[model samples]
Target chain A: MDSYQVGTNTPIKLKVGIETEAITMTYPFLYHSEDDDTPYSMISPFDPAQKPGWKQLDNGNKVNGKFFRVVSFLRFFNSFPDEETFNLAIQQVKDTYEASLKGGDVSPYMMAFELKSFYKDKTCVIESELLLT
Target chain B: MKKIVLLSVLWSSIVIAQSGTEPTAALQNIAPPSSPAFVLMDITPSNIIVPENIQAFSLQTISAFSGDSSNGLSNNNYAVEFQPYWYVKRERMDFFKYNNLTTQKADDSEVTPNDYTGYNIFGDVWKRFSVSMALMNGTFDVLPQAQSYVSVGARTRLLSFKTKSQINDIKSQYTAYTTFMSSPEVIAIFAKPGLSPSEINTAITNLETYKTIVTDFENTLQRKPVFALDVAAAYSHFMGDKNQDLDDAFGRFGVWASGDLAFYTPTIGTNSHVHIYGVFRYLRDGLNLNEASDLFIETKTDYGVKMELELDKLSFAYEYITRDADDNNEERSIGSIRYKINKSFTLNGGFGKNFKSDGEQVVLFGIQWGLDYEPSVVLGAGN
Candidate 1:
């Protein structure tokens, strides 16, 4: 609903809000510039001790353009009881993000979070795209 | 009848004693697979069961309880089926891989629907796995009167195969959707200044092209697989009479497999299919009580075939199954009809002769419903 001004030196801040009863998780937002079609992954660092909630992506020079696309992947959790796997996956995602900050090459963090096989449908994919001008 | 009432009261007392509350909520929330309820009613089309759809959480009751003598509360049966997968949490880190958006080509080409078909098929099997539990009050052939029993069961799809047409249809729909998303109209809507998320959604959905493409794609996705195989197993336990020490006797144990061959029948309706099913099961029965009130076991094997015509919201099916045991052979022939009143509720009825019925006809009716809870999504600006 909100459009961003491109070509400005000001940083672009994008925030997403979710309303759901299920546990919610999100992947790093993918930013694609009109100048270059390649998608740049933007990660929002979180304090491990705090609860996960809305994530804000702040992009400075990388997002300065007339038009760009922001792709976000959101997952909602269901009542399936596999907490062990969920906790482990969350930890791994955080670990991968931390490693990437140190110039790690592996993009394993890009893999979709895994759940026990049958409960997959309990989850829904909200793949949204935001257009900036 | 007196004994049945006493056993029902005893079971109710036990439940209340354990939970310290009235059993109304708990009783209303139990649902079993329709096939098993048929078996309990002695009107099962076949002993080998293959449930059509499994919900995350479902509830079913045989007779409505009105807290009055006329409503048959004592004879009520309740069962529940749930998928454990929905109970677990899952997180996907590799978004590109899960959505099949990753491409090796350097040109930044968009991923096609063909890229998604494989992932979808792989996920379909897991969605079919489910577990069920039921509490029922009924009379078996060897029992002098109705008694309470409990059953636990599980089912899963063993194999599923879709036709080439199904795959191609998905690909075509995906291509259309991709084109529609990038169309000038869509881009203009997104480029509009000061448009709210809900407003944008409404505008897009109101478009004729958007509606057609989405509805067609969804309908295509809902088509039945050309062929599928499913397996299930269940075990039930009988509770002894009210006056005696509770005899936790094994009531029935059954393991079965079923295969379905379905053909799309769009001529009848956009969402219609003709299905042929084959099933086989091995069952061990122990509800038979002798004069001394001791339970005895019987081993039997059953095989059957069924034909069903599914027309959008209604379906009609007929099946004949033969049961063979060491000392006797019995047959079950039944015709059944089902109508979906809505997404959350359905009505089912079946009539015919059951195994060992000695030509006595049986008619049974049932209802199934699920507790529908869905998460809502809202898009807004970041503060």
Candidate 2:
């Protein structure tokens, strides 16, 4: 509303877009489980084509771009069958340091994921250097 | 793969051109003053296609048109193709199925009626990785009485090369155009000196009237490229949850970018298009659109320079832009003419204009009555 001026005039109050990325490529609907959680049935994977470009000037420690992944299907259905179930699946595969994600969806994607459960280091990895909007 | 075999042979020739019942034969090749059916989640040459599960059913009639009579009418409550009537005006991008799934004191708390669908497709194994899981359901189908909404989106991409690719010497046809990149904070706010650089270049050339939307997003991000990106994570619920009356939820992002470079093609040896396309859409609802009276939010960021030349039946182009809602809005020039009007017709006309005059100044008339006729009519009429 009359304040966008990223020119020689500079003003530029708001309204600018172009940040892309934070999530690389993947597809492993390939399964391996223990009543499932081989990373949660691979949480729906099949991205025929993806690029993850733009959003440079990565300094400020990279910050934003990660959206929790369905609240870990609500803590993996709130822990269905556990005996320490790999330490509650290693606290649901670690990473997702909870910077600005208290709940689920509504513009949430700091794009985090870095869990490690023994027996094959249980992977969920999606911390692609975080820098997407 | 060849666009999934040309959309599965256009969905089996539109289901054998419909017979017994009236599935409407692919909505009669869509777009009779309202063609809307775009479902190609994402294709990048700068995010050239992220139509978002697109679903369209239309036949608008509130007693309109019919005056100068080019003829089209019916009686219905469905008015699709009003730029997709912002699709059901955003009921959280729509997806419903709630036959009672409550949860409270009975189990302490649960309401399984979330029927989430905020870009959730997560699973596309080998056609190359693509994952999805969107669940914002907040609201804002282009300001649908928008006072609140929330969104969360996720995306992925990779195709360095395998299954079909060749990197044409690392893409960049032209990137040498910067006269000291002027931006002394935007010429120090309309610099003084009796103010007159042609009235600030004819009022910023009125943002070059959008040069036909920068030649239709630079001719579909250079016809097609490889490895694309589009991330749309949004969360908005303006006015939050006031007594559940709600209207202030927020978080946002909508980005589309692209990159492609491949060469050597006698007729498909190894080819690539889509040099670079970077799109970004955002919204942060502090609400207060000046207390609403014409609440506005318009932003279509840009930075472009592209060229293509595909001979043999011909396909050529040129686009140059640095847009931000143009007033002379900077640049655009497209001149196209494709004519195959035979084997199922094809005749698209063109000519886009705008040099620097803030966005959308037009004229691009078009026609193709069934190109030789087989349910084909590729038009481009603009103004």
Which digits, one per residue and each the tens of the lDDT, describe model 1 over residues B20-114? 32323321221234535334334232344555545565654443221111333334466676665445432332332322223343222333344
lDDT of 2: 0.26
When just chain B is superposed on the true chain B, each candidate scores a TM-score of: 0.77, 0.21
- In candidate 2, what are the lDDT values of residues B183-302, reduced to their tens digit? 232232123223233443333223333233323322322333333343333232333554444444333334433333433244531222323333333323233233443333334454
Q: Candidate 1, residue B49: CA error in Å? A: 4.5
Candidates' DockQ values? 0.07, 0.01
Candidate 1 regions exceeding 4 Å error are: A1-133, B1-53, B64-70, B89-111, B115-123, B242-246, B291-293, B371-383
Model 1, residue B248: distance off in Å is 2.0
> Which candidate has the highest DockQ of all?
1
Computed on C-alpha atoms, the DockQ of candidate 1 is 0.07
lDDT of each: 0.52, 0.26
Model 2 spans > 4 angstroms off: A1-133, B1-72, B75-175, B180-192, B196-198, B203-223, B227-383
